[model samples]
Target: MIPIRDTAPCYSRPLATWGLIVVCVIIFVWLQFLPFEVSNPLIARFGMVPLRYSDPSWAEHVGLPFDGYLSFLTSLFLHGNWFHLIINMWFLWIFGDNIEDRMGHLSFLAFYLLCGLIATALQWYFDPRLEIPVVGASGPIAGVLAAYFFLYPLERVVLWVPPIVVHVPAIAFLGLWVIIQLYEATTSILFEGGVAKMAWWAHLGGFIAGFLLYRLFLKKPPDGIKMEDSSSFKI
Candidate 1:
């Protein structure tokens, strides 16, 4: 399903969310202007490569930088193509604003990076020797989706499900997504030798991290407001 919007209202401006979107777009556009040879090498240098950490000998042989560990964080801002960038940014736009509104800007940004890091770590643990560069914002965006799922469980998500646009409870929408990601992650590990082009493990890991960690980052509710009460949510 393609998510259009959610029923949850944001009292504060999504400054951090907008800032992240702008940064990703600017980086993508700049990379597009560079030649494939140049851009590809840059991505390889900065994008998360599991093998670079799994085998230092091979990493040295391939001349991957010693500080390649930074890729865990840096790769979040990189994208392989326009579709990847657009879809990730769209997910962020859909889910991130409310998360930022709930956690406040800096806390949301920190939570995002922490989730991305944990997601990267999980992917690396599962496919330690895979020699592929994983780039894009999907991991952190998955985290955002998980946060939205918990914080607004009963909130309705407006989606275009083929011929009709319908509203579904956030749990139903995000639960389906979680199930799909779990299935894909399992299939990839068993049948694909844990080497699917898409990083399903990272997606699952990010969601898990966010699910377990979001409450810690959430801001205290004002006065009589309850944080998890969906009855007061806006449609």
Candidate 2:
């Protein structure tokens, strides 16, 4: 199901969320413009390769240097195609603002990166010797969705189906998503033989991480520094 939006009301301007979207868009545009041969190299250099950690010699054979944990974060900003970039940015745009609003700016930024790091690490753990580079924001976006599920259990998510739009309870929508990821992870493990495919483990890991970490970071408005009562400090 394609998510059109949510009905949740976020009172503050989610500047950090907006900033992330802009930065990701700018990077995607730059990547799109690079010469085709160079673009692949650029993606490889920056995208996370699980073997870079498990077997640096194998990673070197694939033209990747010993990245020393940097790709865990860098991979979040790289995308394989326009569809990959757009879909990820779209989900981030939809679900990220409320998360940023509740956490304030810097806290949300750190939360995002930490979630991404854990997501990549978990993917690496499942297939330590894989040489293919994984790139995209889906893992961290899954993290954001997890936070939303925890914080806004009753919020309505609007799903678009051609000319029809329907509202599903946030709990139901996110619950279903996580279930699908788990099923996919299971199938990938059981059926893929020795090949790693979608990084379903990353999605599961990020969601699980967000589930665990959000309570630590979400703004306790009653005692925390109060955010301004504004529509959106949108940039």
Candidate 3:
């Protein structure tokens, strides 16, 4: 299902959400302007490479500090293409504001980064030997979806059920999404050596992290306040 929007009105502006989107846009623009291969070599030097923590050749060659911890954060800002960047940012835009409203700006930012780090750690744990550079905000955005599902499960969401467009409860859409991720992860494991490059495990990892972390970080709304339906507007 393609979720168009939620019905709830955000209590706060979600400054951090906008800020993150802006930062992602700027990074995406910068990446587009540069030669694709110019950063290809650098990605190997700086991007997280699962398990094998070998010395970075580019770091040594360029006399730069190649810290793994730093890469955990930097990888979120990098993407493979315009589509990758747009979809990630779009997810953040749609679901992030409500999450930010619940956690507040600063706390939401911390929660986001924390989830991203944990998601990366999980991915690395699963495939430490792989040398492919992991990049994108999908992991963290998946966390946001997890948190959203818990905080407002009943909120109505407008979605297109391929060939049929309709509205459904947020929980229903997100729940199905999680199931799909689990199925993909299982298939990836069972059907070894597939050409599919999507990181289903990362989504699973981030979803789990978001589910657990929301309990700790989400703030209960004030009494008498009600969340709105997310699919009130027609696209």
> Which candidate number would show the highest lDDT if scored against the true structure?
1
Q: Give the per-residue lDDT digits (tens) of candidate 3, residues 77-124.
A: 778888888888878988999999888888898888888888877777
TM-score of each: 0.94, 0.91, 0.85
**For candidate 2, lDDT tens digit of each residue in 169-235?**
8889999999999998888778867555578888998998898998778766776567542223311
Off by more than 4 A, model 2 = 194-197, 223-235
Candidates 1 and 2 compared by TM-score, better number:
1
Question: What ranking of all candidate models by lDDT puts the best one first?
Answer: 1, 2, 3
Candidates in order have lDDT scores of: 0.89, 0.84, 0.78
Candidate 3 colliding pairs = 6-230, 7-229, 7-230, 51-128
Worst 10 residues of 2 by lDDT: 226-235
CA shift at 57, candidate 1, in angstroms? Answer: 0.8
Better of 2 and 3 by lDDT: 2
